[model samples]
Target: IANDNPYKYQRRLASITSATVAELDVAIPDPGLTTAVAVTVSDPIDVENGAMFSVFQAACDHEFAKLIRHKDLRRYHSWYQMKLREALMADQRDETIQNGYMQDSDEWGLPLGEVEY
Candidate 1:
């Protein structure tokens, strides 16, 4: 908390959130966050415009549980890891923008090519 970097608070928040997720064992159903798909696509999904995130959220919510076998948990973890890896990649490379700790909508995720840091 002594550092002066602008992203310090955001980093702290992320750390807390991650820790909470890691420790979570109860799955409280949230109806307001519920969404449904009108149709299923057999073809590949193109997430170039950040559409996959919504699906990810819904899937996680739908799959939430209070407990699981060790084997099942490991399998779930690996599955998520693989899918998340794909989510962050595009054009055969990482599409994640290291835009620092921007807290503002206009400032967050601003590609370095478009503006100076």
Candidate 2:
């Protein structure tokens, strides 16, 4: 059996997180002998979201030079990149707060003291 394209798997996983398969217009393929299948949809919303995520990930994977060189797509690519960055930062902040790594001024308990040798 041929191995599935890892990129397709990544795209499907991303799509599911951002939108449901139905919302993404993704069609569930009939079970067959093939071990690998590409998950895609005919809906414009699904297509745009999938493409945006793919391009953003490509840029993050060190393909920013190539992505930015496309003048027509630069705007969309930049928007996706910024959105992804913001989402990541928000998630990190939430995680840090939840783990007690961050504290608001009102939540500060005490100040650290310098220890002299």
Candidate 3:
């Protein structure tokens, strides 16, 4: 089969081994409650971050399918949509640095600014 047919070349790759939960921080400004939780995956799926994201999308799709029966499902879909956007954006920003797609502050054209909580 020629490379032109991508399906013929499809292969299963091992899961990402170099990945680790960098940090987990939580804060509640109102009551001044703060905590740090650790997250880890012992056997993560063998797929790119984009594939993992697609899993999330599939879940959203499944929920949407159920929305046809229950009107309240629409509310869940709206909430999940916002959460999906936030997760995707955060993943994109982090992956840019994690995957070596971007260099340090000096390499980037834009100047770095302090991130506010």
- Candidate with the greatest TM-score versus the true structure: 3
Candidate 3 C-alpha lDDT tens digits along 1-117 = 234334312223334354542322332234322224322333344545664566476556747657566655545555544444455456665554423223354544232221111
Give the higher-lDDT candidate: 1 or 2. Answer: 2
The pairs that clash in candidate 1 are none
Ranking by lDDT: 3, 2, 1
Candidate 2 versus the native: TM-score?
A: 0.22
Kindly list the per-residue Cα lDDT of model 1 for residues 1-117, writing each as its tens digit. Answer: 233333211111112255223212333255442233122223234344553664475346435621433434544544544454445443345444343222334743443223231
Model 2, stretches more than 4 Å misplaced?
Answer: 1-68, 92-117
TM-score of each: 0.27, 0.22, 0.28
- Worst-scoring 10-residue span by lDDT in model 3: 108-117
Count clashing residue pairs in model 1: 0
lDDT of 3 at 17: 52
Best by lDDT: 3
Model 1 misplacement above 4 A: 1-71, 91-117
Please state the error at residue 73 of candidate 3 in Å: 2.1
